[model samples]
Target: MPENTPLLSVRDLSKTYQAASGPVEAIGSITFDVRPGELVCIVGPSGCGKTTLLKCLAGLLAPTSGSVTLDGAEVREPPKKMALVFQEYGRSLYPWLTVRDNVALPLKARGVPKAERQALVERAVEEVGLGHAMTTYPWQLSGGMQQRVAIARAVAYQPEILVMDEPFAAVDAQTRADLEDLVRRVWKDLGVTVLFVTHDIDESVYLGERVLVLSSSPTFVQEDLTVDLPAERDQLTTRALPRFTELRTHVYEQIQRAKRGEAVAATP
Candidate 1:
């Protein structure tokens, strides 16, 4: 794929579910593109159908109209070249499996050879700074460490695009910061395309090269604002920047407007 072309494209996508009460619209229409090796964060008002949009992108659910295409292929089911990391680390990891086995599960399922799988697992685990706990079980690790294991699992899959659904939401503030840095490091090191969904305005601003803000349900993209922060960022120094404050404040104001039923047109 050309570097300038979108690695993932979503166009005119919408979802309406058949509910007991009546047809319920979640995403009214959404359009966005994630280019190769870009780290894009998605933020929205509460109940703005972020998860619903993610599900459609991952091909876990079909859209009512429009389309999600990964690379050049339409995504009708979970794509093998894509990997997902959910927020609930405790639920995603296996209590019975050691860290190595948990991280190796996806590779093994894809029919990766034992020797090659072990190498990928080891490298991914080390990348996430969990090399010392390769034998530790999920039940024995801290919540943050467990989330690291989940991230390692996704990394080992060697996905072309990684879609993370609020993966840091369950950790403490300090741990969340650490995990956020870890994501940046891995993204830089591996050059994987990342589409992260989070409800955190500050986090979205801090982590993304561009932040796509969604409006209240039935939702449409409220704004697709470029985050002009430096490419290299640290929690303390980056957050202290005056530009960072302006960006977050802008995103917050957009969310407020969205909640008030004000919406801009979907990006074409």
Candidate 2:
């Protein structure tokens, strides 16, 4: 695939649900594109349809207007080449299955041979730093380790694009920081196009190559801001950088502005 070509394209997409009261609009014609090998984060105020937009992109929900395409093909249903990591690690993993089994399930589902699935599960477990706990059950491991298993499962899928909807939201602050670094390393080493949705301004600046800010209720794309930070980001050095502070501040103010219904600058 061409580097300049978009791996995922979301064109004028919006979602409305038929509710008892009437039609409740979640997103209002939002548009954006994520190029191959890019890590983009979508940030917005609470209840701003971030999840709705993500669901549309994931092909788990049909949009009321516009479209979502992956690799030039329209996304009508969940694409096999894509993998999703949700926030709830506890419910994501099976309590009865060992970590290795949990990580191997996706490959098995895809009809991969037992030998190939074992190899993939081993690699993914090592990649997520969970090799030591592979034999343990989900209930036996810590929250962070369980999430690592979840991540390992996604990695083992060998997806072209990985979409995460607040995957680390439930972890502790320190664990969250560690997982953030882990994601960057995984993205770099695997070269997977990542679309990470988060509510944290600092995290958005820390992780994204570009941060797409969404407007409040009846959401739309308010801004498409490039992060412009070094590709090799660290929790300490990157967060301490002057540019990092500036970008986070800019995204922060944009969320505040969106809450207040003020006009937001498109891109900067």
Candidate 3:
């Protein structure tokens, strides 16, 4: 593929489930593109099909209509080039395995040699600032640390795209800030395309190169707002910038408008 091509593309994607009442549409036809090494944050009102869209992108759930393509290939199943980090790290990480082994599992599944797996695990752990916790179990660490282990696991897989679903939603304010910085740093250092789904307006503005807002249920793309923040983001300095505040306020108002039953036109 050409270097300028998008790393991922969602074309007219929509998901509808057959419920007892009637056809329950999770998202209306949605379309968007994530370019190579770009950080895109998706924000939407409650029950706006954010999770459904994510599942479609990750190939966890097939879309009722349309399709998702990664690296110019249709996503029929979970692609090895992508990795996902869910909100519930407590359930995601295996309690029985030490941090190093947990991060190494995906590598092992891919048939990586022992030495290569160990080296990757070491690098991933250090990237997340968990080098000292490599010997610790998931249950032995704090919630934030456990999430870092989960991130390390994803990193060790060496995926080209990282999909994070509310990864910082459960952490305390301070911890969330630290994790956000960690993700930004790692994404830049590794040049991985990232699609982050979060409900937090501030977070979306602080971390994304652009923010995509989804309308209420039967969701479609409401707006695609570019975040004009600096690439070198600091938790304190970035968040304090007037531009950050402006972007965040726009996203917040859009969500509120979406919840009020405003019809959102799909973006081309």
Candidate 4:
């Protein structure tokens, strides 16, 4: 693929589930792409098919009507080049395994040698500031710490793209803020393409280079807003800026309209 080509592309993607009431459309035809090193956030109301979209993008579920391609290849199943961090970190991590082992599992599955895997795991743990807890089990750590372990595991794999599905939703406000910044820092340092889904408007604007807003159930892209905030964004300064407030208001109004089944204008 060309350097400028998107790392991942979704072409007219749609998903439907067979229900007793007949076919229920979860996501309507929608299209988007994630460029290498770009951070894209998707936001929508509850039951707006955000999770369905993530599942399709991660190749965990096949789309009923469109395609997701990575590096010019169709994603038929879970792609080794992509890693997902879900909201439920407790369930995502193994309680029986030490933090180090949990972080190393993906590497081991990929046939990475023990020596390299150990080095990668250690580096990742330290990056997430969990170096001192390598021997700790998931059940022993606080919710924030366990989530950090999950992130470390994803980073250690060094996937071409990282897909986060409301990864911080289960955490407290303070921890969620901290994790948001951590994700931004990691994205900047590692330069991996990111696709983050969230219901939090502030979070979507805070962490994303561009925010993609989706309509209500049977969802489609409602608006795509490019966040023009400075690269060195902090919660206090960035959130208080006029531009930040403007963007947040814009997205908030768009989502409201989406819930009403009205077309929303793209961000100017």
Candidate 5:
């Protein structure tokens, strides 16, 4: 791979499930790339295989056809260079473990040294503003704080890419907004490539440098809209701005089209 090549790439990726009812295709052929340090969001209608794509990218589920590559190597299993955060924070974090312990588990799995793991865990928790809750268990924290601990754990792993699967869907609106901002801050500060999947058009537009819209079931890429807003996005001011509104409207329209099973143009 060239130095400037994407840290992760997907080509003709598809997933199918065999049920007693017969074969069910979840995702159809789709291809895209996530360049180093880029924040890309995938959005589509419910049951459009957004989560399936994330699973394929994370190597949690093998695609029925096509391929996913990480750092120019075909991803056959979970890559050490990638970390995933799911929608259910409660299920994702271990209730029996302290926040600090949960955050440090990935490092431990990777066999990182004790001193280095401690430092990384501390830094990640501090970055996510969960330093005060480090000793608390997941059950003791609010929904938002639990999610932050989950994110802090992913970050502590120091993965080259961070994949989030509708991570804010379980939180209240206010907490969701704060978590979105927190994700952006961490993405910028860490300079890690991010692949986020969400059903919320506004959320995708607000968070992504490029928002990818997928077609309905047996999904494929429908559109990829580059968010042309300034790098520093303020939730209030940015959302109220003309450009942000325009971008959000574009993604919203595309998603509406997808829900109707209409063909939409891909990003230029």
Candidate 6:
């Protein structure tokens, strides 16, 4: 319960799959902790099992060894206090449902009362700047707007931790920048802990308080680097800072090293 204690703890977590040939280890071992209200971004090479690691943390997949704990309890199944937003925004949203209904679905499943659910839905829609699109269906919106709907759904759930796996990858450059700022605004406003996984180095630097770099294939923690930039960041001004360039360049080098198999030992 202490502020310093980790809200989510991952200890020597690993995952291996049984195949026809042999056991293929996706995650060698990864260890990290996310404190309350911290926004942490994870980056690694394409095949470094970042998604696999996130699955274990989300309790959607069991690890081969070690553990993922939320608030001191081992995560066995998807935690009720946690929410996930995936990369494929179009697939996640129900084409049949209106934006309001899609955002309210989770609350409804959780048995939230109709009045409270409506209030939460409206507030979340407005928060994401989608107040006018409440009655529109997912199929009717642009790609970026649909992603906003996905984010609104997560925000409306009032999760303690929001796990986003490449949530902005599908949008265009301008939209991606807008969504990045939106995330920061929402994070600051709600004080929700965030664990974001992205392959983009710049995105990691822009969004995270700490960026955890993962090693190649049999993945491990290559580096856990902190972002020392000011809290209030704009895409143009923040990215142009000399410190930003240095941090991003450093992360880029670490990832390149990871690809070349220069893995540092992860903390046990």
The models' CA-based lDDT, in order, is 0.94, 0.90, 0.90, 0.92, 0.91, 0.94
Candidate 4 regions exceeding 4 Å error are 1-3, 264-268
**Candidate 4 lDDT over residue span 3-35, tens digit each:** 678999898899989999999999987888888
Off by over 4 Å in 5: 1-3, 264-268
Q: Estimate each model's TM-score.
A: 0.98, 0.97, 0.97, 0.97, 0.97, 0.98
lDDT of 5 by residue, 79-165 (tens): 989999999999999999999999998899999999999999999999999889889999999999989999999999999999999
Compose the digit string of candidate 2's lDDT tens values, residues 155-213: 99999999998998888999999999999999999999899999988998899999999
Q: Which residue pairs in model 2 clash with each other?
A: none
Query: What's the C-alpha lDDT at position 69 in model 2?
Result: 89
Model 6 residue runs over 4 Å out of place are none
**What TM-score does candidate 6 reach?**
0.98
| Model 4 weakest lDDT span, ten residues long | 259-268
The superposed Cα distance between candidate 6 and the true structure at residue 152, in angstroms, equals: 0.4
> What C-alpha RMSD separates each model from the true structure?
1.0, 1.6, 1.1, 1.8, 1.5, 0.9
TM-score for candidate 1, residues paired by index: 0.98
For candidate 6, what is the lDDT?
0.94
How much lDDT does candidate 4 score?
0.92
Which residue segments of model 1 deviate by more than 4 Å?
Answer: none
What's model 1's overall lDDT?
Answer: 0.94
lDDT of 3 by residue, 1-268 (tens): 6767888988989889999999998888899888888899999887788888888899999899898989889999999999999999999998899999899999999999999999999999999998998898999999999999999999989999999999999999999999999889889999988899999889899989989998998888899999988899998888889888888888888999899987559535
